[model samples]
Target: MKLALSALGLAVLTGCAAVSPQQGVDRANDEAAGFTQGALNLARTQQERDDRAQKTQTLLSAPVGQKEAVQLALANSAALQALLAQGWVDAAGAAQLGRVANPVFSFERMSSGGSLDLGRALSFGLLDLLTLPARQGIATRRIEEAQLRLTGDVVDQVTAVRQAWVRAVAAQQTASYAQQVYQSAEAGAELARRMRAAGNFNRIDRAREQSFYADAATRLATARHQATASREELVRLLGLDEAQAGALRLPERLPDLPKQALEPQAVASLATRARLDIRLAQSALDSASKAQGLGVVTSFTDIELTGRRNTAFDADGTRSNARGWEIAVALPIFDWGGMQRAAMNGRTLAAANQLEATVRAAGSSLRQSYSAYRTSYDIARHYRDEVVPLRKLISDENQLRYNGMLIGVFELLADARDQVGTVLAALDAQQQFWLADAALQASVVGRPGGATVASPAAAPAESASAGH
Candidate 1:
């Protein structure tokens, strides 16, 4: 009875505590500070909503940078709020497992031939009381798992926002360049027409020039549409309403690549601490191992204890009272809980293997992400320092040669046309570098966003157009 009272007191203390959604959001903000930029919130009131809206507006008032975009999404996204709420719900459910069910009370009364009888009983699950401490341990691990999941999910969401912002800004930059290319092609085509009419340019050369102009127009249209699509995608990820969508602005260009790529040792150091996947898997294994141990006793049978009191009265006004305790154990004669024990064993084994798998894969995934990052950084740097400058040099020399009358205007125009592909390809390389950078940030935190490299020949088909 003393032990029962002690366990009941423990259960009462654990049961009365409430789980707060803001707590989970705050935890995520702390754990995923790099991804969330420490701006995560869950607005449960009108005041908070207004404050969040104002913050989002302030962010959208300027051209959204990569980090600012992630901050805005954390502040404004309803889906993110739902995620926090769901995490709270999961945490509460896990906490519920640590508490014992309320004790049951029973009452009965009967009268026969002026004789009266009354009975009362109180009952509870004895197994639940005995296992309270173990159950609480399991609940603690599950709650930990929930928090890690919340942090990992926030990291993924913020990583997506960052990548989308990069794509949108890059697409906007490319579109502007495409427009410039189209205008230049149009001018060259008109000049070619005039030269051909004056009999200074051949029919085939004029046709090629016109074909280039047509292709440029097509490419410009595609680029504009691509820009629109990318911007809309960003808007969606940021959870913008119609007014907010209209007010959205993206940077005119992708940010310049870092001067130096992250060192391998630095990356290893970053990934070594608090990786979400490994921690989550370890939490699962802990919960499963604890639950399996508890299941060994619970799966075979259940024990219930009841305290009973009875009273009887005769017609002569005499009364007698009876009091005792009863212990009930479930009979496992026909159906033992073999399947329940088997399932628990299987889950424990699965969790152990999963932790091992995550441990083995973590380093490899980080390496792949780093490789993509470095490769992209190198390619973009090569274009910036080598290919683009070489193209500009060629264009400038051609213009000087034309001024000296060593080359015809047609040849000068052809040289300019050839430079278009190089410029666009350089833009593509820069875009991939930024995207890879975003993915690498995510992978370091253990949420493996892919960082696939674009092919070297990412320029449009018109870049390969024939030149005379």
Candidate 2:
């Protein structure tokens, strides 16, 4: 009885304990902060969610910048909240798997000729109890995997927000230039009409001016629509309502290019430590290895042990007691676990291959991202330093010639229109560079955003040549 009592005490103490999902969530938020530079959280209670909503309101109350936009999404996005809640459920389910199956209880009674007998039995899976520690290890690993996955998801979301902000702001700037071009064309067309009425301009020349005005109007319309569409895209990502969208204000232009491009060596170094894909793959491989080992014992056979007790009373008033235990083992005669073992082996092999593939691909992926980053930087820089300045100089010279009566008013108006087009192209180049920059940052951190570098806008010289 003493031995049994001691064993019972040990079993009770060693039983699996419940794990809180907050532990994993907190870990994920911490790791994600390094990449997103914003707070990520799971609002488990109504009060917590309300608090986040209030914070989101505060952010949207002002003109939202890129960083502020990320914060707003983190606070306001229902989808992100759902991801967190689902992550908790997944982690809790994994914890439950590590726990021992509930024990079975049985009771029996018999009465005959004034004799009474009772039996009680309690049973549980013996093998599961023996392997509880291994199962717990597997569960821990699964929780880590969940945390890493959450971090990766946050990184992706934040990257999207940044890129969306860039596009919206660039579109706004482009639309302004488009409007200027339209107004200039309208003025020139009106002047041509008046000159034609006075017999100073021919019909062909007047029609050419009208055609330019018509094209400018179309381009202006397209640009305005593009700006609205991009702004709405940002609004959706940030989870803003109509009122909040109205309050949102973007920068006048895209940010200037960085002073120096990221070095290839720096990118390679970050990829080695920061790649989440490789980390996830490695975690999966570890999980498969642990699972395969655990499966070997469970697939072969199962064991159930039961501690039983009985009592009996006779007609003469004499009482008796009985106590014993039973062990039930599954026999491996008719069905062996060949298929189970085969599946386990296959899973292990697949995991190994996946890890290898991720490792091999990581460097190449970083290299490609870096190439885009560098190329975009160069193109945008060229436009800023070479193309825009030359256009400005040419416009200045044309203005001077017009003042001297060396060029006609039509020639001056055309030059002004061309200069606006050059500015529009420059804005596009700047937007593409920033988008590429955001994508490169995401790739450096292990969640590849798959950012594509848009082709650089045609140079003003090229446009002039093509016209000739």
lDDT at 339, model 2? 91
The residue ranges of model 2 lying beyond 4 angstroms of the native Cα positions read 1-18, 109-116, 269-274, 313-319, 457-468
Number of colliding residue pairs in each model: 0, 0
Candidate with top lDDT is: 1
**All candidates' TM-scores?**
0.94, 0.90
In candidate 2, what are the lDDT values of residues 64-109, reduced to their tens digit? 7778878888888877777778877777776766777777889999
lDDT value, candidate 1, whole model: 0.86
- What local lDDT score does residue 387 receive in model 1, on the 0 to 100 scale? 92
